[model samples]
Target chain A: MARMSTPPRGRPGRPVDPEIDSRVLSAALEVYSEVGWAGFTMNAVARRGGVGKAALYRRWPTRQDLFAAAINSLRTSGPVEITGSLYRDLTQTANRLINRFLGPHGMASIRALVDAKIYPDELGEALDYVRQSTIIGGRKIVLAAVDSGELPPDVSPSLIMDALAGTLVHRILLIPDTRRAQLAANPEPLVAQVVDLVLRGVGWQGTVSTRRTESGSGEPRTASEG
Target chain B: MARMSTPPRGRPGRPVDPEIDSRVLSAALEVYSEVGWAGFTMNAVARRGGVGKAALYRRWPTRQDLFAAAINSLRTSGPVEITGSLYRDLTQTANRLINRFLGPHGMASIRALVDAKIYPDELGEALDYVRQSTIIGGRKIVLAAVDSGELPPDVSPSLIMDALAGTLVHRILLIPDTRRAQLAANPEPLVAQVVDLVLRGVGWQGTVSTRRTESGSGEPRTASEG
Candidate 1:
């Protein structure tokens, strides 16, 4: 029995501890939010995570490696399964996207990532991975809608992704005081309006769900006129 | 006896020498492009401009002041005259935008500006001014279309601005080898498509002028179906 002690490395499922990995990653984000990318270091991350420097080093050989792993950990469950019409799916996804941006971490994290791109190669690679992974789930939902004929087949993924995310990011970066409550207050109506606008632009044949009123004049919106 | 002497400020309506100021600004952009914002200095700019350091100091009090001056010198023009239709006006403007980006200074200046924002307060202020100036003309063109019943009045101006400019920026930033040629190659069709998409989203009542296909699918589009 004394001779039967097995090393942790030899076990099939013990390659890396998922729980410790998540802790390390979250700690990295915490440090980033405090000191920004320039100030972030592997040593600071280890201190934040309450892990030994050696353990942190064993997992992530470089700062970018740690950052990219941290980003992967932040990614939530996929496909935004809201069952209904195309409008419903788009509206739900848009709301989720806005909410995620408005969360506790907020847009500073994103700005930090963009700022990081100005430096060495690892940061660029890590930022790209973070950006792409963040967008991939939303894209999957849009693609799913297209497959079901909820959206036009020829509509571009790139255009939609850029427009929606870019507009949100612009708001976050320029206006420092915006809060999650403000963002979520009436997102449904705006989301509904945008979804209709985009669906129509993409050449979908459907009833325009959100009728818009003229600016200043606030003209009455009547779908029957069109 | 009073000695008749031209004031040290120089001739009226030409108080300062344009040649030196212009030279300094141009040289600053050159240095910024090569060494980036962190390395750019007033002394280096003065040397590049072939002006005495004292003259440069006399004009610009600080690095920020010089950077702001240089950014302010960049030219931006027009609420491009509408061509009786949204399609023509939008496509014409898009082409002009592409030309500005692809021209002599082109993308390097933009990259410098983007990099600048990460560091200094002066750069941030300069960026704000530049961003506002760049979008003003475009906004006016879109507003004109709205007045002409080409787009819905309810569309958020800021959101629209972000979408148009941000889409272009995102493409340039994310894609490794994106070129102005790639954008301008079939500028007319792409612009027309985006215009139609925007118009439809905004609840504009107009005839679809072109039969453009969706990106992945080759099917010709008809407004009636949309």
Candidate 2:
């Protein structure tokens, strides 16, 4: 089944084995994570994959090309399935994203991308891919809720997504490890708070009871009611 | 008058002159902006400041110490003054921050900080300083509004600050130059939208007229009203 899912590689008109292509891409990610961009080399990937360097060159002529393909392969993780309620959907999705970013492979991949930013052309396209997959992917749920009349017509999915994902990244980057560990142990409270902020910002008219039920436990309001 | 503001320095209690201290700090920023982290050196700063390398090392034994001091010096730009209205206060602050990040010196300083992240301890303290000065500093206005009964008491200032600063950083990092240019050219619309989202999210009871008056040229609403 996995073999059937692999796409063919090499010259457009020429027949090439997909297994080799998949192995090479996987090996590329491993190499990147280990040595980062500074030490990432075609020879290292070819050796790690047990494939000829010529094969890699033929398939991806530049390091950027290979790095991009490796990033694409990382996207195999399935997208979040939309649940009926916006609060439920967003919280679940936020938890999954937080876990992904905090995980080792995800951290390494993100660091690699950050390293790539030193190169203007490479970083532009690479960052675009990340924004589309993460930010735009998250927005789809908000758009669906808007269409279904769950959220107000004025709700900007773009703004909501930016606020949602941006806050998550900020916490990850700025907060101490101890605090992050605590948040990770129970992300629901943080997730609930973020969703509440964004929903209110968008002026959602949904009952507060919905959020209360979703958060599992209610805490006293810290600021004015939205 | 300026001399009175200079703080005392040195363990010898010799009262190191503030003029030399400020000059060395300024020279450090100039060197960092020119070469970034990898090429940053104590000798370079000394040369730029026209001070002895011994003098530079006497005050700051390590590069990290000097870098931190230089970052501290940058903070002298002054905090955003409260303008009574939350919308005006936040937008004005946001514009200043966005402009700073987009500016050459700001860009260089951020890049240096990111480079410093390789040293976990150094980066943690450095990033914390940035978060306190920029993120927490921005939140004061929101807190004052809450205190003034302009916003709901339930609104979380921490969450709002995180969302606001995070979204700004996200936009700066993710969006292409062309789109950033557009936002930079006329930041009010974006600022207004962000503030509106935050206000509504917090459950502000003020007539939405406050936002309309602040936005200057109200656009048609695309989403549902709060």
Candidate 3:
């Protein structure tokens, strides 16, 4: 908290190796997603990534730094694109949210959100980006829909985002690890159900054709398609 | 997994002390919820509860056993009672879900669900009760509603349950600890918004009077009441 500015990455270490850095970053996420912050330790990351304690410490001085860097590394994937059509935009957003949670470090994000409640002071700046964005990430989607008159001006964007993210998280939490692969293989059905329900729940006035075009199935599919 | 039937409580040890047993159980939930399973240890529980290792082990021989006992202790509150009306039933259900998650042992339950994925075999039968119930708990509500023709016959109960549970969990996960008291002070507003949105989304054909009776507010308040 005392530091006024963000420190340069790999500052203390003697010019870090990209190969080792990449390995350590992946290892950090894997460890976090598996054991959570309570069980997260430098030793575990070192042992898992096959790197020495000294190397791991030098490259990233603190546990928070290492975890933050690992989280920031995922920044390349970027935010959900705002694709004009409210129905498609949410479907794509829901898909992105679900796919991300099921991704390699997806479990880490889910665990982090819960852990943040327990350990409020633990996360550093870079790590805070995902935590902060995830809650308000759908603001853009809501704004676009409201401006375009697809959704009511009074709709709570957070509710819609949570309904999507939380439903997927709940679904994922319920699915046994053994079946995750099968769900991952066919995410469309899950996405379809969630997106369609959310759209109707929020009273989206978007075109009917555009709504079903992306959503593979919903209760009204046969009637609408006919 | 190999057990033929549920084992008796205090089976391994001689009769246990109710005083120490209660302390140890509470301590186990605190430790698990605070640090999760990764950092969960008998020593921590012993220290937190101010009980000796010998006393802690006498009642619950294994870590899983101790944690299972701690989780099972919460069964005293019993399941959510089913009210006949769909609107009131869901509203009550949502409140119960939110209130439980906000309770002392609530965090432990949430954390355990995620950890179950990482350590599936670690959960003993007793502990598995909460996890199984949470996913399928709202079936009774759906059955009653469908029977009464309040909800469409084909409405997916799991979806409704997940949406309510997941949305509230998502909301709780976002609120900072500092603001939890403010949110907890009055949960009625949150319940109203979520229930109303979900009711509309699911195409509830229930009478307007009953739907808004429990829900304090929604966007359609003016038009409906008029």
Candidate 4:
């Protein structure tokens, strides 16, 4: 939990255990992903995590609070590190996104995104944390590339990042279950393919050697055909 | 709803009302969008559409059947007319996708996508229909463009379509509700910017006049600055 260490305001002596918070929050994401906002309840989360209802509520008073914390917690867990090169940075980021989306809590993410959009009046803030997870890091990479002369100044970070994220997601959405195992095993090639295309699209001119996928050319990334 | 006329296998004599099926399916999408798979109950859909549970169950025996049918029904509802010219066709299709994503049931579509990804056993086929609605038409346009000398023969349609879709969806996901009206009102400019960048990336060489967004340069498409 993002606030596991910081005790609740004006309330003293609440036991602060990172283990319980971590366990509960992880369970929160699992529950949210499985049941979504509609079916999300403190009892369900507590039951799933095997924590007491009091412990769950002590951390997050409401279901929405718990849901948002789970999403925001993404910032702390499994972050996609950013080095400088546009090609390498984007490839790394896309690889992380592909792997995460193919992970267990991916459904909760979808539900959160949908809930945020459909019920913006209620769930809009949920998207803020979600955006922070990838959009913030992605925009920084694009901006840094521009500053480093890899990309032009006139380009919109929104446009470039969207293109990258959009393509990755579209590929995920379109590929069937039959190909899923192969994709999960080899996200590098597909990530590289998308990054290269977007970099080319946005007019990035990197040296041939630093290009992404070819670096991960080991394993059954089979048929560098395209 | 996608098949109102066809009788159930070996189970006939059930009254067929296209009107009810349409209303019910429409409601199903709306309900599903608002409350995803977990909260998606036939009773909720029946109540939302004002149709009895018996009517819904009779037409479609299961929730998944109703859900899948609703997604597939998109094929008949909004056929993005595919004339020639890759640039024009993609812009039109992007425009439709943007508008639809901004529309009421867009959340449902997002849920369906996430559900399909997270629970392939349960929802993978939902994506097939979603892909057919956009991917099939997009590919046909790209293929036609390639054959007509507008694009190089070697360009992967998957790369191109993913670029287009990924960009649009990413934009939608990133923007807050505040700008949604402006985007929905004039998806043309944003659509054009994406199409132009992608087309340039893929090396499509259509003349300037045939470019998409400039045609919608009317009203506050504001400062055609991009």
User: TM-scores of all models?
Assistant: 0.63, 0.69, 0.84, 0.82
lDDT of 1 by residue, B1-226 (tens): 0111111122224318878888888888666544455557888898888988888877876777777666555554544665656566666765665565445444444544444334534466556555555455556655555555555555555555554554445444443333435765655555555655665656666565522222223322211201
| Model 4 deviation from native, Cα RMSD in Å | 8.7
Candidate 3 lDDT over A31-67, as tens digits, reads: 9877787888999999999999998887778888787
**Quick one: best TM-score, which candidate?**
3
Q: In model 4, state the lDDT of residue B82.
A: 44
DockQ per candidate:
0.20, 0.28, 0.50, 0.56
Q: What is candidate 3's lDDT per residue for B133-201, written digit by digit as tens?
A: 654457767766666667776777777877888888988887666678987889999898889878887
lDDT of 3 at A78: 57
Model 2 vs. true fold: TM: 0.69
Question: Which model scores highest in lDDT?
Answer: 3
| Residue B127 displacement (Å), model 2 | 2.9
Error of 1 at B143 (Å): 3.3
Per residue, candidate 2 scores C-alpha lDDT tens digits across B1-226 of 3422332222233428889988988888777765555557898999999999988888887777777777666656566766555666666666666676555455444454444444456555654566566655666777767765677777777777777766766666665655767777776776677767766677776653343223433453221211
Tell me which of candidates 1 and 2 scores higher on DockQ. 2
lDDT of model 2 at position B24: 87
As a whole number from 0 to 100, the lDDT of residue B22 in candidate 3 is 82
Best by DockQ: 4
How does chain A of every candidate compare to the true chain A by TM-score?
Answer: 0.67, 0.67, 0.80, 0.80
lDDT of 1 by residue, A1-226 (tens): 2221221122123328888977887888777654455566899999999999988878877676666666544545444553434555566666766666566444334534444434535456555555555456457656755765667777777666655554455444443232435645755654554565566666665443422222443454232200
Evaluation by DockQ, superior candidate among 2 and 3: 3
Candidate 4, A1-226: lDDT as tens digits:
4633322232223539989988988998888887777788999999999999997778777777777778766545554554657877877777767766777675566567667877776677656656654555666676666665667667777787788778887777777778878988878888877877788778886654443323332322211100
Q: Give the C-alpha interface root-mean-square deviation per candidate.
A: 5.1, 4.1, 1.7, 1.5
Candidate 3 regions exceeding 4 Å error are: A1-16, A124-127, A208-226, B1-16, B124-127, B208-226
Q: Which consecutive 10 residues in model 3 chain B have the weakest lDDT in total? A: B217-226
